[model samples]
Target: MTGNTLGLDKILNALFTPYKERVPDVNKITQAMVAKGLINDDSEILNDHIAFRTLGVPHLGIASFEKIFLHYGYKKKSSYVFDKKKLDAFWYEPPYSHYPRIFLSELRVSDLSKQAQNIISKYTSSIITDPVDAIDLNDYEKVGSFFYKPLWKLPSKEDYLLLLKESEYAAWVIYNRYYLNHYTISVHELPGQYSKLENFNTFLESIGITLNTSGGIVKTSKDGLLKQSSSVAKIIKAKFANDEEHMISGSYVEFAERLVLPEFKSIPKKKLTKEHRRDGFESANADKIFESTYLEQTTKNIN
Candidate 1:
């Protein structure tokens, strides 16, 4: 599309432009997308990030990330590399303004091997003062860290997954915020090493957890993986419940109730008006008040 097209091409160009001076060719872009299973054919137009959505489950999402790194022969921590100047800018400033940013949540790695440390230190000038501080450490003693860096120097899947498993909640928040609803999943291209849905379910059962796929919307049930099991399903479910309740009350009902009520002081007087004026109003008001109060109390209790 030559960076001039109206649709996907334009989005791709914008995403790639910051790094274009590095001038990653069509082959590099296609290879990355293919490794991530973002596209079926390498020859297909390298377009929008939404193209990533076609991949199902862990395929086009976090699972595909491992393949992307392996394809480049980059070891998790051992091959870590980034632009020191760019990283310094992010560390010293608010993350919102950083250029070519890569935001990875709860990246866990315990006892980074010497090889890994050396690789990471090469590109990032930040020194590890405390051994424990180098990796992410969650409240439950999970080892992981959230990182924001240049896209060109993002970490590998092994490192990212370790972080995710250790701090599952944080990992999910990151995935939901950045990956979910944004990327597509390609079910057919899932890695051979990945477990099947049945196997995943078995693992969940062994851990005394049950996945609720009752509604038949797989993504909500399995976090979009058809064949694989999510280690974070329980955590994701909790998040989903909280989010669903918030959306229904905050967006769906709040405005309607607000529109119906004038002020509590006005309600009693309005009810005292002539029979014609108050005909159905009192009953309607009572119902609305009951519903609104119920929702507000439920939200407060949950919060």
Candidate 2:
């Protein structure tokens, strides 16, 4: 049951390699921002967190997915519920201070419409047992494979649309099972201009990356402690069960800048720490951020 069989550092590197490969933009921007910040090679390019979305079916929800991180020294933290979005999620604090936090959310299957439930159940029903139970959680490579591995057959285009209409998050998991949703850069940790989401977003826009404007250029929490935005998902060609290929939104990258609370801002820079910064995700902010991958957002830029 040891999740650190390969050592946490090595395991995380192995896990993220493929994610960077699939979503090239993450690396592209991370590298650019790192240089923009004039950060030296030794310092870390802080990642606020990495997120993953899953269906709430038996064997597929956060319960199963979280074990991978739990094994790597992450402990469950705050719980967030999106009533309108029908999502239940939790954030996990990493064992290592420099490592990114983990945010995992699952669609509340029971909250979905009957038709949507039936369509999702049809594909996931075959997974009668928890697939993670079969894995040697300590085997880093094997555990990494679980994220990209497909768990069920492809859904028909009709079923995909049906699920999308009810739950954009559900439709996404049905086809893109276990793929990384988005990785957020901790803009507050960056040096100079890149340290603010507003400035960082401007730099991103200059490079021709399309930002998700659902809630605004920047989605701010009610308390104004957390500011976040994401690039609209990149469209990738996918062949549905119907044998028709269509452009579907794949994963994208997110940027977050968590500010120090008013009470802590007066503290000297040298004495400031992550604890002084705003922590945990906001449901209202995340609710709009989720639209980054919706079909409407996906096709908005298309000519």
lDDT of 1 at 298: 25
What is candidate 1's lDDT per residue for 246-268, written digit by digit as tens? 12111001100011122333555
Please list the C-alpha lDDT of all candidates, in the order they appear. Answer: 0.25, 0.83
Give lDDT tens digits, candidate 2, residues 1-303.
244534666666766777777776776676675566545542366778888898898887999988878877789999999988999999999886778889899999989889999999999999998898888877767876777777899889888888878888888899999888888878787777778899989999977788888889799999999999998888888899969776778888898999999999899866778889998899888888889998767786686
RMSD of 1: 23.0
Number of the top lDDT candidate: 2
CA displacement after TM-score superposition, residue 8 of candidate 1 (Å): 19
Give the total clashing residue pairs for model 1: 17
Q: What's the lDDT for candidate 2?
A: 0.83
